[model samples]
Target: MINHILDHRYELLEHIGGGGMADVYRAHDQLLDRYVAVKILHSQFSNDEEFIEKFRGEAQGAAKLSHPNIVNIYDVGKENNNHYIIMEYVAGQTLKDLIQSAGKLSVSESLRIALEIAEALEHAHANNLVHCDIKPHNILVTPTGRIKVTDFGIARAVTSSTMTYSGTIVGSVHYFSPEQAKGGAISAKSDIYSLGVVLYEMLTGQLPFTGETPISIALKHLQEEPVSVRKLNPTIPLIVEAIVLKAMEKDPNNRFANSTEMIRDIKRAESGLLHGDRQNNAISNQDPFATQILPRVSDSLPSRKSNLAPDEKIPQTNLLKSKKFLWGLVCILILGFFAGAFLSYGKFWSNAEVIVPDVVGKQMTIAKQMLETKNLRVNIAETYDADVPAGEVVSQYPAAGTTVKEQRLVTVYISKGGEALEMPDVHGLTKVAAETKLKNMGLKLGKVEEEYSNEAAGTVLNQTPRSGTKITKGSAVDLVISKGPKSRKVTLPDFSGSTLNSIETQLKSLNLKAGTVTEVTSSKPAGTILDQTPAAGTDIAEGSSVDFSIAKTEKATDKNTNKNSGKDASKDTNKDTAKNSKPADAPKDTK
Candidate 1:
């Protein structure tokens, strides 16, 4: 896919951002020689005829919305089956990534980003567009700290088109408005509700609602009230909290009428001024976008044709009567069929009581055999057992030696060793993290060693009990921490037409160590140092030596040695040379 773009007018350089719907690439506009962001519909959507139309339509609608705070759309194009929109490239990170990178930003910074986004929303609202998805992931903060909102009006536009089908939630479950979740009407206030969620996440470093499944989370958004932002961050102003609560109200009417009003309230709160009707009027007067556009309600399920028998077709008015009669007839026929089959296949016998066998002390295989002899099947359920031996039955669901049905299935719990604990994800974590996780898991630190590495200096790396290796709780594990880069003192060796060995000896006097040496063909002599360890200008302690090699004469031929030298030189040309061919004064090789 990327290869196709190399010859394109806008050359895609690298992928900068992506989401469930599309991918954003940093591209160079060959004609203008300027960078532009190219957002292309995901391949999965590109082939979807319905989604392709919606994607293109939404891009067009969003392109019409232009504002300083909003990312400007330049062009929309289709190359083969790939559909893409060119937009102004803003060099920045998304608010979500930034918040993740820097946990819980200061209140002021959070507010600043929020204010810019609100202003952008106000602009969108004025243009008769509502950005249904207003989460932090959609907001970008440039290097200069200026905030810009992308994907304006696209969600609503995409939702309205029947081509995209129904039941597909347009916004993130964590930030969706109650109406959106219920398949009810949406409006500008819906965006405000999403903005409230973003504010909550920025302040708390987490979403308001979370669950194992997307549906569960969406249901929570629809029915539950989020935790207060002030509760997460005490530093947040009361007015800010009020705004958030109001915006997050399940009732759309309860939220701020527009983003402009929210922005005004935020500013007033920051200034420590009480907001009132007059302030509302002032904010409303300044609002550039105040038009009301009712949102279209979407169905909970996409339209699907049910597979029904030919006899199911009935007039609309008589549908219920016909359905009830048909169902009753079918039920009676099914019941009679089952009764006849059972009577033909079974032998009726007198009720006989049998004692369930006691299999507690028996091995699982033997126990299964015993149960099978009595017309019982074993249902194995695995669980962690700290006190029970692995592969052994820990307990049985039904008490043994109890009378039951002949074909009754006995459920047994099997031991699978101790509960497997996942290695805590500790990469890029601080020393405090290592200690906290280790202690929480009843583990202790044995030894801490710091070494040089490109990773954060204090970050944990190699541990004695490597991650995922099961060990008893409270075991002490040695942790190795990165300590930045390695630093060493190297002695300076002189290379004034002296032998490489002599230079190494000089380096040894300075307390420096020697490394590999190489010989270069030079006219100086057969054994003269072209360079020395520690490079001549390096500072080093005394009593250290360096390995040195001399420049060979042009006439000297050692094919095997030269071949080896070439390979070594290719690996690293920093090897020291013999004395007398000091690089500083040695003539450049003519060959």
Candidate 2:
């Protein structure tokens, strides 16, 4: 289907990839003049009206999600037997390809990619959309290390029907969640489980579970625990492994509550890794895979059996009456009281105090060094800031200048830079729609220039910085609006002495049409122009038709020729009769 245009808008360029239910093609959107990926449903699924409707509905729902890490669905449509979805064309290898080529990724790289995927899933889940299938194959990795999760709604739509159709499951069996394997209720946690499998594969370069057949692999997902990621790849961090296991829990309840929680844990793990802290390692040391047995309790306590019961009972009463024992106890209590007082004074009241430094607006490293110089401990927290540069402190605890004891923990907030996102494609959208979309995305409309074009009036024809460009929030976007097609006037060219065919061709070249061709008897060659309406050199609007009168060479009348032939026949008959009569008389005498 190369070169085929869908809905007269998307031109199929090349076949890129395919799966069980659809074939993806790289296509060019003619209206917007931009590249897009088109996924056409397989014939088997397209013929099913129910599946088609569900697929369309799910795709539409997924299209509502606008995230940098998620492939955007631009349009959904059907042409004849082909049901297709136009999506953002991401240019890069799949995560599966990257893993295969690199064997396994480093712990830091794996966590980075996994975090991006989780954040994308968090956005999808927030919209109540679950990407039932989350595998390396569906994750696209750009050259710049950006991750984009694709096929958001397709998995949900596929799972809505029997997965055993055509003896195949819609998603990869190795990555299936236990609930999905058992045909149970699917939720956001299902995606978390799949993401865990993806992360596991990314870290280990192998699927967590595999078998000779899809059924065996799916059974493994349902009934077995995957080997520890660290066991497969010793370089993987313990906390990263813990995350994978938690997300892949057999019971959905045991998995992350939602993608947001998973994202938070991933971020925490990443932060710990960056700071070289053992906090996450200590937390992850409690292996989730280990079995725990509760302590047993006794119903009743056994009675005590003492060998010197009588002597021991007598000592308790005698001890209270002994004057020597009382004097010894009084001396010991006075010594203990003095020691406690000395320890309390040294621990809390005698420590030196230092004023917390003003670290706001300072670099994180510099601030930490300054705080540490005063025997103070530094704690870091990061947040996005549009005005402040990254790695700089935005705020600090205790108002930045409070007096506190030595070794006090000071929390400083660092800027992570301005919030950036991929600019959305707005070409062909009406003015109101474009404005509303920009406003919703925290962007502002800059300048709107009007230009005459074939597009409808007020439609966006061009935009500055273009789509897919990385832009910060609140950035201004300029647009060029269409003013509709231009109405142009054309000067009628001289058609005098020109053949009718030439005149017609010239009219067509000028965007004019031949209105009527009238034939008239004239002393000129046939098909030659004799006269023309609205004579030559007259100005006319484009697309106006020009009428023409052409020369016609008339044929001589047939009646005169028929009369001449009849007279010749009559003369020949008279001559033959006279000759025959004379010859009859002479021939009779000779005989």
Candidate 3:
């Protein structure tokens, strides 16, 4: 499994992490040449056709959703016996890990994470999808403090069915909504309840409810009210605690209606907590997205689904019971027709115009509501934006505060966030040159690895997200650069007890050199080699030099010894002659 390449594309590199359901591995996508996290469903569940189909459906739908706080799903497939999902490879620690290490987080920090999670939920809920599981384990926090939610729908399909089949609640008992605990129908509010549990854990460093067994803990969710987060962690703000308690209400109806409502209240809590506002309930602080009933059709003509023109003559009525009844029906239809015409004409002339409020920076949901509130129709056009969040309008045609007739179309260019771009060709460029190109294209250099290649030294031989591949801006491109041909090497050969000329020949044979030949007279034969540097069997660069020393031959040592002996003998002879002549005459003997 470690080296298995799924679909002949994703090369499994190493197992990184996983939860109870899947074994996650870090893989390299050969087609795109990028790092991806591949989550393969465990074999235990492979035979469950119901679970597999549900998992596949959920993955498909989740893949369609794009949010800053949600980990992106790239692909999902079944390769033979393996069911796998390739997703955004986020380099971060799990929120659970962070909580374990930090114990309890600060008030502001907790809200920040919770708010982001809520935003993500709102996005998914808007698409009519619920993230059944919302816990610290499924949440990831980047080093930069950016929060991302993962396992959006996979957990939902797995837990719901697995619980049914096994009659055992799994890992998420601590965060279970009471309704979920009861095996009742679940909705977005159920997720809100789970989020409350997550928030409670974040603030208190422990689950709000716990018991000896999963079922018991689940029962606590169904029957027990958690200790106020404030009680567990006194530092938690009153508003924050209230928000948590409201979300974790036993009845789903008792919780925030949806992600939007929860987000609204969470924002209020955050503001009150941050500013220390006296009015902790700031739900009505301001809503960017506000709307009113606006005509879906043009204001010029009264909106009517029927094809019948307002001026068209009334058709003969069907008589029921008597002629008097038919005549009465005729009169009623004529009068009603005239009344509708007059009312539409009068209302068109009398209806007031509301200024198109500034909703450029507001979320699309809020902006649409604001437009509808003004009796204006929103016409959206999507484009990429880097400075603004996705779903925010880049610009409005009628502009802010512009007076327009009711039902007027406000052409809003909404942002879908940064547009993905095709990676450019950077092969054959030097390391510095390639990096410069990537930076210019709003990309970053990922990993830089060197390998021996025929390509020029330091030139890029290949790049991940190969040229012309569409990828989001700021995506790192791993590169493979050539370190030129591998360095040439030669092994040192033993040259001990070998003549200088002979050793030089041997070094040449090995594509090496004899560095220096030192001759000295010793018991070891001269020119027969005493020792050689780089002792033997050592690998070094081809043509590298090896130093050597050789002992002098015994014959040469003997010749020098005899010369010294002869000189000493001559000195002794002179001394003897001088001594013998000294008795006769000291001056004559010295001469």
Candidate 4:
């Protein structure tokens, strides 16, 4: 597929990397004069229109995402039999390659990379998109140490293959969240869990879950706790380790509610403000032996009455009257004893316990009243939320139904509508960079308009909701990008002494095709290519035709005639010799 151009825009240059069902190629976008990475689906699935449309739809959703750390999608189209996606090409190795080469990175370096990835994830989650697959191979590390998280919505279309060599999918199983492994409901928390696995790998230079088979690894993701990062690498900070563990909690409810929460905790980890005891995933660190074991009562109910020997019974008395008199004296004694016991015990029995009520999503005032009436102090923490409306509680700590003593602090997060973000400066930046900027700010991409400018093509010239404009989450921003200076000419490549197949490849690469064929007389053997209309290495407009010819060898009749003449001459000589020597042989064929 090399040298093939799709949609007359992206020219396939070289194969880069890919998975079982796709191939990634480094290509040049002729219209924009920029290099792009083209990902084309495998032909095996081309006939399956349903799968193709699914992939296309996912690509469309991915195209809508824009974040500094995400590889920007430029276009998606189909040309002939090839269905492809054009993306911003970064000139760097994947995080997978880096980790493989370095074996392990320092704690600070790993944290920096992890934070960048988290920020990208936060933007995606805010847009209601989840990356089902998260691994080092999809994370690009640029020369400037910037992280670019790629393959956003495409992972949803990537079905798991049973083949073992499909390292692409199998390798990702190591980082799969428990729900993902079980094929359960996937959400933002799932991504956070995968990111936590990535963090663990970064800190320890090893996968948290691994096995000889993908199924085994998946099972580990579902049922096993990962080895501690700090235990593997002591240099990792306590808070950083805790953040990683907290995010990897197997239970979705136990994990971060969303990427926003994870990012918040990550930011605090950078300052070492998180405590070791706060790790939700630290349930793995707990020593089961240290837990107090309460003796469990047998499932058998207590016997209602003990077996009695009937023959031993003798006399029956006024048991009720005698018991009443004894109970009266005991009651008097208990009252006097309680009076003395209360005087000695200060306030052990004074505090009452109440079951915490579920107040999340309720109006802040109503929730406050509910908690106050329950004798629990309401501690309100205001924060922005896209899903929860303003004045409503977004979430609560020590979630409802937990029994706690009176006057206990119950923290509630009140929503303040969507978070306000300023439009970032994107002028002079590439279209991909601008899109990433918008996405990272929790904004969507609007119509992309192009204009001719002196600046290089693909560079952003203008943007709407102009830079620094404060906007709520999920807002749309339009962009005007340069189409590059008009260039009607293209450089022709050398095609000397090449076969028809090679010439055809060259023609496709140069966006030109053979127009006419003619016979040419030359010293070369027949069928050997001879010449072309326009000489190689000349500049011409794309689609301008170049004619070529093949050599014609000598006529076959002439060779046959020469051979017949020689044969006749030899036959005549043979006949004359036979006649001359007939007398010596005594007998010759008279006929």
Candidate 5:
């Protein structure tokens, strides 16, 4: 797809990267005149409705988040089946690459990168969004050491129910939370857990958990605890290790409450390091088995030491009675506790159980009625489905046959049909503006053709499929762009040897004009053209000016002087003849 343009705005320049879900490319934004990253969903997933939803979800969710450490999303669109997202192009390497090259990062660098990632998460969580997928592959680090957390492909909005279905794992197994491994509900703390794993990797140069298979690794996340960061790298401070541990706690409640809290802790750790405060790092330097003095015990029982010195058996009966009374009290408390637990268990067990009816492919209204008839509550969710008709049930929870207690909430997903919108008019707008509008409306730019028209150049003259036509998302719309009015060319002809007036008339007929005319004395007749500025046979635009040189006659005074000189010579000859003949004969004798 290189060289292909998406939405007529982003032109794919080169393949930059690829993952299981999409291929990333460096693209040029024609409208903005800037470079951007374009991620196009793999063709295999393009037709899958579930994948399409998730791909679109990434754009929708990430677009709402704005932070310096979070890559910015500029646009989202599809051309035919190719779904794409335009984002800020980060010219750097992935965190994974950094780890591989360096084997591990310094303590300070790791904390700095982690802190930036946490801040990004803080922003996303504040907007009520959870980034389900956070891993080194998604983290980009610039040459200047700025961190960018990107790839919210599996991100979803925070809601009352955000549980992952059983057997469905959405993120990288090694970096996901324990709750995510168990397909439990996800929250902002999940992102914190993933970030913690990333920090561990940065400090240790290896993943916290590894196995031959994904399932095995996921099980490790659920059942095992990772080795402390300090164990792998002794240079890591105790407080920094503690931060990683807290963020990676198995239970979400045990982890950082949110990214904000995590950020605060990270900042405090950085401060401790910067100030050379050994208190936080002193734990590793302390002696584990150091001895300490104990306080002295005081004598009780009314100076019993001296009074009962002869020892003896004076209070044996009283002591036995007290011991028996204590045992009796313990037994009574145990019995009471069991009784309460039994009663509570029986109360819960007494609720009637009902089978969930099959509602997949049923109309939403009918499905609701059916579930209500079974005394079950319905929780509805809507999603785009190209194969399923609108309002039809796509799937139901609990397998539609599992026994559930009365009043149990059964979530039913309803189809919203194929995503579509009415095409909008883009005529008369510049190419860039037209593409931007179409992309925002979920349309793709199709083949662009240029034609000469009275409209301004680069302006859109017309569009295919017309406005108001309902088109599905990712559908392409062709456009005819204006190249301005057609130009007329004129071939200059030889004007030499032609009269000046005649040349002017010819020029006017040819839509050409005569420029400055210079007069020159030549043998040719007056008013005759001598030379032309553009020579001859030159192609020029219509109405262009052409310079020229014209011939003119010599001055009349010069001809009059030559005639007078000839007459003077003739008179001189006549005088000589008269003197030679004596009046005619006298002049002959003298000769």
Candidate 6:
């Protein structure tokens, strides 16, 4: 229960989140003197040794990853038969809530979320872990807009459990990978596939695939191609759509190899940093016809193997004997031919002249064929040349028309992409100015950091790419703002002549605090204020405390007189009484 603390160390405060297998509570770790999020395994799962082992393994694995975008796991333990994990307590809402509330996000905003998620996945993949669940629900968007990925390795544990039971996918159906839908082995590519689904949902405000049941939805992931993203949001960049489609390809080989590769693509797409060949309307670039004609993927079927004809299945012993005989015959023919031909043609071949083929600007495969026709071998090397498109030969070692010996190797360099330019600084500028500068410089602006400042209040004061610093084009620039001076000024109220109650009210009105009050003998009445520090006209910061002394009227003098002792004293007392009784309103001093 939320009211319960674990091992008396984590004091459960309130219920923050829950799912079928676990419940999360906001709690305070008294030992650490900080707040933490405690996720406890559901009672049903606690008794399962397999589930417990998996959960423990995932927790330990996630604990090894240190990334700003990923939630940090602090501690793991069991108390009173309850298994719990302590993690960072982030005050924010999930990305799902944000997307649902906004309906849809701007291209730039969606790019921001995508990039952050990609970075988190990149780190996890590098550390040999996969999030397995890259959905809006697992991403927390802070008040400042920074994204923190939660439930990292926990998904792997959950999926493992699901895998043990046949015919079930581990993750959410909406973000399932094609392989996942088929209940196949999970890998880093699976995470990439889920990320693609998350990106699609963010850009188009809808899931690419959906159905009445989890199985049906998953089948769509395996068998159906999603509708183009640009169809739903015309403003979606062609490059972004291409990246998403590539990541979500049903064939794992066609998708990114890992989160790092996927992240690189996302970053490039977000920054318009496409390789040259990939430029010029990436959306229109379709998969090659050869790829489209690929043999049916039997891996998608429940039966992991395809049916073969009886004749197609050769006996193992016969197949091995045939392979050995073919190898022996080919070797003998090659030796005899070389022995005879070398004696007659070796001298002529050594003196033979070959013309260098013109292969520059041609695709690598085509260029290689062209070079081979001249009795010259091709040595392919890749380089990033800005002027040449990717997959095209940017340069050749042997210039066109040059003469070389037969079968000589000609080195050709293929272009990969353009050289990246260093990013520039544009901090302290207004939003409009920053946007214009970043666009003009071919750079991208990242999340801005705003805070209260004394100098340059409410204005941009600093940026990630500080002035005069160089960074590659399309790199993110983080901006910082001034929240305004830490304090404000207020004019001290004129409490010199006002009563203590009235002065307190005046101070309250001015947002000033009142200090200790001391009563002292003064000419004014008992309740009236005497004087205040930081005089009335002096200006002081708001919330400053003011101290004043209230007047204490002189106690009536107590003295005894022998008035009734003598007639003379009696006559003097009578004279004083007559003066006092003359008129209560009249002052003795005035008379």
State the lDDT of candidate 4 residue by residue for 406-458, as single tens digits: 76778888777777777788899998888887787788889999988899999
**Which 10-residue window in model 5 sums to the lowest lDDT?**
157-166
Top of the candidates by TM-score: 5
- The true-versus-predicted C-alpha distance at residue 323 of model 1, in Å, is 55
The 10-residue segment of model 1 with minimum total lDDT is: 344-353
Order of the predicted models by lDDT, top scorer first: 2, 3, 5, 4, 6, 1
Give Cα distance to truth, residue 285, candidate 2, Å: 14
lDDT of 4 at 561: 100
TM-score of 6: 0.47
lDDT of 1: 0.71
lDDT of 3 at 96: 96
Residue 265 in model 4: lDDT = 62
Ranking by TM-score: 5, 2, 3, 6, 1, 4
**Worst 10-residue lDDT window, candidate 6:** 286-295
Considering every candidate listed, which one attains the maximal lDDT?
A: 2
lDDT of 1 at 82: 77
Worst 10 residues of 2 by lDDT: 287-296
RMSD of each: 29.2, 30.4, 27.8, 29.8, 28.0, 31.5
| Candidate 6 ranges beyond 4 A from true positions | 165-167, 273-591
Between 1 and 3, whose TM-score is larger? 3
Better of 3 and 6 by TM-score: 3
lDDT of 5 by residue, 117-209 (tens): 998988888887777889999999998989998876444421111231212444577888877665556788989999999999999999999
Q: List the residue pairs that clash in candidate 5.
A: 580-587, 580-588, 581-584, 581-586, 581-587, 581-588, 582-585, 582-586, 582-587
Q: Clashes in each model (backbone N, CA, C under 3 Å)?
A: 33, 0, 10, 2, 9, 11
Error of 4 at 460 (Å): 71
Give per-model TM-scores. Answer: 0.47, 0.48, 0.48, 0.46, 0.49, 0.47
Cα deviation of 221, candidate 2, in Å:
0.7
TM-score of 2: 0.48
Residue lDDT tens for model 2, 25-126: 999999999999999988988777777788889999999999999999998988888888999999999999999999998888888999999999989988
